[model samples]
Target: MKKIFLVYSFLFSVFIFGQEKSGAKQFWENLQKQCGKSFEGTVTEGATNDTFRDKKLVMHVRNCDEKTIRIPFFVGDDKSRTWVLAYDNDRIQLKHDHRHEDGSEDKVTQYGGTTTNAGSATLQFFPADEETCDLIPNAAANVWWITLDETSFTYNLRRIGSDRLFTVKFDLTKTVGTPAAPWGWKD
Candidate 1:
């Protein structure tokens, strides 16, 4: 009687939550085609005369499929490191692969990504044992927030674990480029 009702209620809640997650994923799917191509910009670290600036940070994003994305990043014409993004059920997952110039894996970094129903996605990088909740212990991590618009995109990053709150923002407007291929419908 009461036990059966409790089980049914739990099942209903699970189903509703699953649908809500699917809705969030669908939003990302809609932009799969347009997310490809290349973006180049400068990346700055630190401040003042000691500040390190890499103007050759090339960001190449490719739409592998409706469920996967690949971004290859290079610093100062180096071509051995890359950041990979692939769909993990309703969310996106990020992987950092460092390699020698000859293409051997030097190190591996694991990162996580999540996208909201709104046109915003976050990529978070941390140690595997670290906890990421806003409350409870408050572990620090490197975070990137990307907000998309029909004609432009905004990228912001925050580096945690420091006494100073270090933040950077890049505002870019879309330029002329070939149209993105249709997902699932085109080759």
Candidate 2:
């Protein structure tokens, strides 16, 4: 009876821990599956400016590793933006790395936050962090989320106390050839 009880306990422990690890791992794997792929995206909502209007918006899952992924977003001919997602210390972080055409860092770069919860196997949220608040005071209330499913990936952002909202959706079923390297990245 004692041996049987110990075996049951071990199995239960594995089931519980395995579920938690798999949730994160699943999301990471879903993203990794898109590595080396480029997808066209559209501004689905709250695109309040001409920046994205009539532009060829593209997102490339450019680089990936065990702990990090780099996705560059191209708007028309501009290649100044990259989104860096990193997993560490049991948390996921999101940051925007912006650069100029000449490979110089933009002043409003590296602004984002970390996930506050074990979101899900398909979604994660990042609320504005202290650094983001300091860099863009008006964005202090921002929250960003990314969702991935079998068919598509979506990136959304909102500011809790304001009219700010932005959403971009990319189709996963189709991919385009990789574009040129991002502004600051060497080929």
Candidate 3:
């Protein structure tokens, strides 16, 4: 009876972990398809910042590895933001890397969240983690997400229990000129 119980437990745990890894792997692969490509985007919704709306936006899948992917997000000429996605076993973490003009880290750099569950291949949600809340108190209720489909890729943010919302949609059907390296880095 004891041997049977041990075998059952081991198999159950393996099954659960395998399920978790599956979704993350699929999502990672989907994003990897855009590696080495640059896409033009627009602020489809959000009224908090007029500057964002007026500027041209671009996203470049600059680097991708088995466990990490870095995407530089350009706003007109401001290349301060890079979205970092990292995978560990079956979960994915999303971090925002903000840098200064001199290749120095910004005050509010490296704020993001980790996945609590295996999200679908086309979409994943990242709620503000403890680090993000500590970095920006008002962002305690923030939730960021990305969605990739046949036609477009969208980066969205919503503040829970508030009216704050921002969404940017990138056209996947076409490619654009690659933007310069983000601040704090050289090509």
Pairs that collide, model 1: none
Clashes counted in candidate 3 amount to 1
Alpha-carbon runs more than 4 Å astray in model 2: 2-13, 16-22
Residue pairs clashing in model 3 are: 103-184
Could you tell me the lDDT of residue 155 within candidate 3? 92
- Scored by lDDT, model 2 comes in at 0.91
State the TM-score for model 2: 0.92
lDDT of 1 by residue, 1-187 (tens): 9999999999998888755535335435543645566555444334544232634444555546766665555455565545555566555554555666655565443433454323323332323223333322343455545444444333344556664333322223432332332221133
TM-score of each: 0.54, 0.92, 0.87
Off by over 4 Å in 1: 1-27, 44-54, 111-140, 151-159, 163-187
lDDT of 2 by residue, 6-82 (tens): 99999999888755564566788889999999999888987567478589989999999999999999999999999
lDDT of 1: 0.46
Q: CA shift at 31, candidate 3, in angstroms?
A: 0.4
lDDT of 3 by residue, 72-155 (tens): 999998999999999887888999999998889999989989888878888888999999999999999999999988778899
